[model samples]
Target: MNCQTLLIDDAPAVRLQGAAGDTVTVLLRGAQVISWVDASGVERLYCSPASPLKGPQAVRGGVPVIFPQFAARGSLMRHGWARMRGWTLQPWDTSAPEPSVSLQLHNAVGDDPQWPHACVCTLTVSLLPNGLRMALTVENTGPASFSFHAALHTYLAVGDVAQTTLAGVLPEGAVLSLREPIDQIFEAVTGPLQLHSPLGLLRLEHAGFGDVVVWNPGPDAGLADLPPLGHTAFACVEAAAVMQPVALAPGAHWQGSQTLLSGL
Candidate 1:
C-alpha cells in the first residue's frame, strides 16, 4: 500500500495516522520532520530542515533542512536553495520492512536564480528496529559542476544539555564558536567528542566529514529557534562538514549520512 495515502491531504505541519497505525506529521513552514512514529516508544529522528553553510542564525535544532550546496558563499542564503523551496512527495516507500519513505525535491526550474544548478534530490527516512536512519542523495541534472556539504543536524534529546558530552571527534585543530558574542569562529576540538555535563554522555563518528561541531546553546547565547526541550533539553554533536569546498562533476552523484545513538 502507498504510504502517501496516510499523508495524502494532511497539511504539511499537521499530524496524521498511518494505515499500519503508525503516525506522521509535517511542519508546513519548516517542511522538516516529514515522517515520525512512536513504534520504539519515543520520537527518534527529526528529518528535513537543511543545515546552514556556515551560519548567521542556522536554526537552533530539529533539522534546519539542507539543499543544492551547503556552505556556499552567496547573496541568496546560507545553504543553497533546497530547504527554502517547497518539496513535493514524489516517490514514497512506506511499505519497506523497516517502515521507510522517500521524498523527492528537484530544482529543475532553477527555483532560485542565485543557485543555477538543475538537480534532483531525495530525502529518505527509514525506521530500524533499534532506531531511525536518514540519508540524502543529490544528483546533478545540470551541465555545470558544483559542490556543497550536507548534514543531518540532529539534536538528540537529553535529560539535560549541560550534563552531556560528545566522543569520536578530532581532538586538536577543530574550529568552534563561542556561546556569547559568536562574533568570531575558533579552531579546536583536536580529538573525539565527549560530553560530561549534567545530562549524559554521547559519542559521534564521522567518516567523510572532517570536523565535528559540538554545540550546546546555553542561556547566555541568543537563539532565534529552539527545539522543544526543557530549558536545556537537547545537545548537538553534528558530523563535521567540509571546511573546504567539494568539487562535483556534471551529472555527479553525492550522498551524506549521520547516525545518533542514545543510552551511551
Candidate 2:
C-alpha cells in the first residue's frame, strides 16, 4: 500500500510508502516526521532513542516543525505550540500521483493567549524515490498583520560527530566543522547545501527559506530528552527563518519548502 495509518504512543500516525521502497512515517501528535528511510532500508533521519513517545513537549529528534516562533525569541513558548499539539490529517489529493499526505493546524486562535492572531497552517509531506519533499503554508486569518518565524528542525544521523562536515562555507569565507558541541544560527544562505558525514552524504536544498541553524549539544551539555553520549549520533542542520521572521498581512499566507536527498 502507498499509504497506511497506524498508532504511535496511542497517537494517530501515517506511513507514506514510496515506489522505490522508500518509506516515511509521521505522527499526528505533532504532525512531525519521526522516521525516514531510503529504498535500501537505510535510515536517513534521526529519531532519538530517548525521545518521549507521547508529549505536550517537543520530540527530541526527526523533523519537528517549529512555527510562529523559533525558540524563546518570541512571546510564545519555546519553539511555539505546533510541535506540542496534535494536528488533523487531511485527505489525500487524488490528482497527485505521488505518495503524499497533508496535516493542518488551526486551533491556535483561542488556545494561544500570549498572541492574539488567528491563523491556519498546512504542512504537506511527499515521499520520493531518492528523497522527500515538505511544504509549509501559513495564512493569517485575523484582521491585523502578524509576524512569525519557522523552521524544519531536522536531526540527521551520522557515524561520528567529530568527523562530519557541513559542505557549504560560512558567509564569513570558511567552512564549518563540528569539533565540539555546536549551537549557532547561521546567516541567510541561497542555493543547496551538502552534508558529509560518516554514515553517508546528504543534500539539503532550501526554497523560499534562507536561514539555517546548525546544532548539536556537545558532550558537555546535557538534555533530559537524550541518552548519555547521544549527542555523538546526530547533527541538526535545520531550515529556518530565525534571523528574520515573516510578516503577513491579513488574508495573506507565507509558504516555504525544504528537500532532503540521501546518499548524494
Candidate 3:
C-alpha cells in the first residue's frame, strides 16, 4: 500500500496508489473520495471543480459517503450528516494486500441535533489493477436497535449524458432513455452491471447492498445548491440501500461496497 498526503483548502487528504497506476484520493473531511484514476492516467470518478472543497457543506461530486440515512426521507436532513462532517484517519497497515487507507466517523466525535444514534462508520478506499474499490462498514453502538440507509453516491463523468446507456434488464443494448432527468432507485438486483458511457465502459459491482440508484438532474432539477451546469458533466449510478433500510441491533454491524472499473 502507498500513501501520500496533500491539501485541499488546507484540509489534509491522502492518496493511495497501486502498481498498475490506479489511484484513489480521499479528503479527511467526510472521508470523501475526491478522485479515482486508473492506470493510463484516466480519471474514473467525477468531482466538479465547482463543488465545495471545504465542508460543513457536502462536496457535490465523487464517491461521497452517505450513511445513517440516504436521503431526506428521514428525521435527519437530506443525505444525512456523514457527508457534511469531518473524519479521522486511522492507522493503516501499509503491508495490506492492496493500496489502502481507512477513515472512521463516530458519534462521539461530533453532534448532529436531529440524529442522536450512537454509531461508528469505517470507510476504506483501495486500488486494484483493474478497479477502484470502496468499502463502508457501519456499526451500531447504541443500546437499542436502529435502521438506516447508506450509499456510495458516485458521480461518473460522461462526455454526453444523452449518449450514455446503463445496460440492464433490457435487451440488445437497449438504451436508458436520457430524454428526461432520471431519479430512480432499483431494488433487489443480484450482481454486476455495466454502464456504457461517452467516457468509456464502466462496470459496477457490489455486495451487501441490494438497491441500485441512478440519477441525472436535468436542467429543471432546480436544486439551489447544485453548481451551475454541473448536471451536464456526470451521471449518478450508485450502490445503495434505499428501497429498505438496514436494521442493526446493538453492537451489530453491516458492510457494503461499490467497485468501479473502466475501459475505453
Best candidate, lDDT: 2
State the lDDT of candidate 3 residue by residue for 1-264, as single tens digits. 567889877768988888886788899988899888888787877887755677657888888898878888888878988887888899977677877899998884237667767899999888877888899999988887878899999988876777777875244545575446899887886557788766788888998888988889998877666766768778898899988899999999999999887763
* Stretches of candidate 2 exceeding 4 Å from the true structure: none
lDDT of each: 0.50, 0.84, 0.82
Tens-digit lDDT track of model 1 for 144-229: 98766555555555555544444334334332322222121113333444444443333343344454545555665544344333
Q: Under the 3 Å rule for N, CA and C atoms, how many clashes does model 1 have?
A: 34
Model 1 earns a TM-score of 0.69
Candidate 2 local distance difference test against the native = 0.84
lDDT of candidate 2 over 204-234, digit per residue (tens): 8877677888999987777887888888888
Model with the higher lDDT, candidate 2 or 3: 2
Steric collisions counted per model: 34, 1, 0
- Number of the candidate with higher lDDT, 1 or 3: 3
Write the candidate numbers in order of decreasing TM-score: 2, 3, 1
Relative to the unseen true structure, what is the C-alpha lDDT of residue 98 in candidate 2, on a scale of 0 to 100?
68
| Of candidates 3 and 2, the better by TM-score | 2
Measured with C-alpha atoms, the lDDT of residue 188 in candidate 2 is 70
